[model samples]
Target: MPPYPYLATDYDGAAAHAAIFMVQWKREGDSLARYLVRIGEMTESLKIIQQALEGVPGGPYEYFEMRRFEGLKDPEWNGFEYRFISKKPSPTFELSKEELYMRVEAPKGELVIFL
Candidate 1:
């Protein structure tokens, strides 16, 4: 996978979010196999979320499909407030896998539990 470019936001301003951590982890592993494995795990978690949302009591499940290619390719920086918090590159940026996993999974698991 190529380095994905995006302005990552922190939810709690505690650490750089998952994507940033993935990019760095991809670099740290520095191998195709490791990179694929890491991404596979992340993708699987996201898939679990998608599966859990299937055929729910809503018009449609929309979280995973919220962003389109055009939006990311040319994102509009209109100063609109984002749902997620922004984490600037800083000395205190935490890049631990445990934190990243918790950030991504805990919320989803909570939602799934509620469902």
Candidate 2:
């Protein structure tokens, strides 16, 4: 379920809240992307956020989010990629984990914003 802020007693309020989430999400995401790149760290957060919003493997809404923080060091990425998929969506629990390609390739972008 979406957060409580998205709940509304009327259609107008619901639309207003949806708009609010869009605006606030962009504003906050930009600011956070900047902050994460501060202190000389090579950053590419916009891409990551896009990756999360796009969802993973199961397609679009299948996965709820994908995130990474400062950890590990590989030539491609100096962090850990977290792909979060909700089991409730497809409910294909019978399949083995290997049957599902859990990891997802992230999006690419070059935008920055900071608080």
Candidate 3:
């Protein structure tokens, strides 16, 4: 179980809290910058996840069966690549452990955001 309330009323507040945290720490400037960048990416991922759960026509799962792409890596990303997978609307689950992929080629990027 998660600590935060899983109600729709709490998502935006939770996300805002997280964004503020990330932004506050973003000023550290170093690994923090990278971390902040990834956090931003994750924020977008969460938006996608929420939309997916809310009956959006196409969601991440439609493009890749997460497990199938778990070990797959992109060949051209420098940092992280936010790949969008499409799928029919469905419920969302809380994630525990998940493997992510990254691009192997020049400008390597994150190829997956597992949550």
Tell me, by lDDT, which candidate is best: 3
lDDT, candidate 1, 13-107, per-residue tens: 32323332123344445578687877776875565445445523455655542443225432332122223432222222356654441222354
Candidate 1: stretches off by over 4 Å: 1-30, 59-115
Q: Model 2: which residue pairs collide?
A: none
Over 14-112, each residue of candidate 3 has an lDDT whose tens digit, in order, gives 232232112223556688687877877687567656644555344354544555445656432212333332221112323345643223323464343
RMSD of 3: 17.6
Clashing pairs in 1: 10-85
Model 3 steric clash total: 19
Candidate 1 whole-model C-alpha lDDT, 0 to 1: 0.41
After superposition on all CA atoms, what RMSD does each candidate show versus the true structure? Answer: 19.0, 18.0, 17.6
* Backbone clash count for every predicted candidate, in the order shown: 1, 0, 19
Per-residue accuracy of model 2 over 3-115 as CA lDDT, tens digit each = 22333346542112221122112335576766654522323334334544554234354323223323334323322322132212222225555553333234553232221
Off by over 4 Å in 3: 1-29, 56-115
Per-residue error (Å), model 1, residue 67: 28
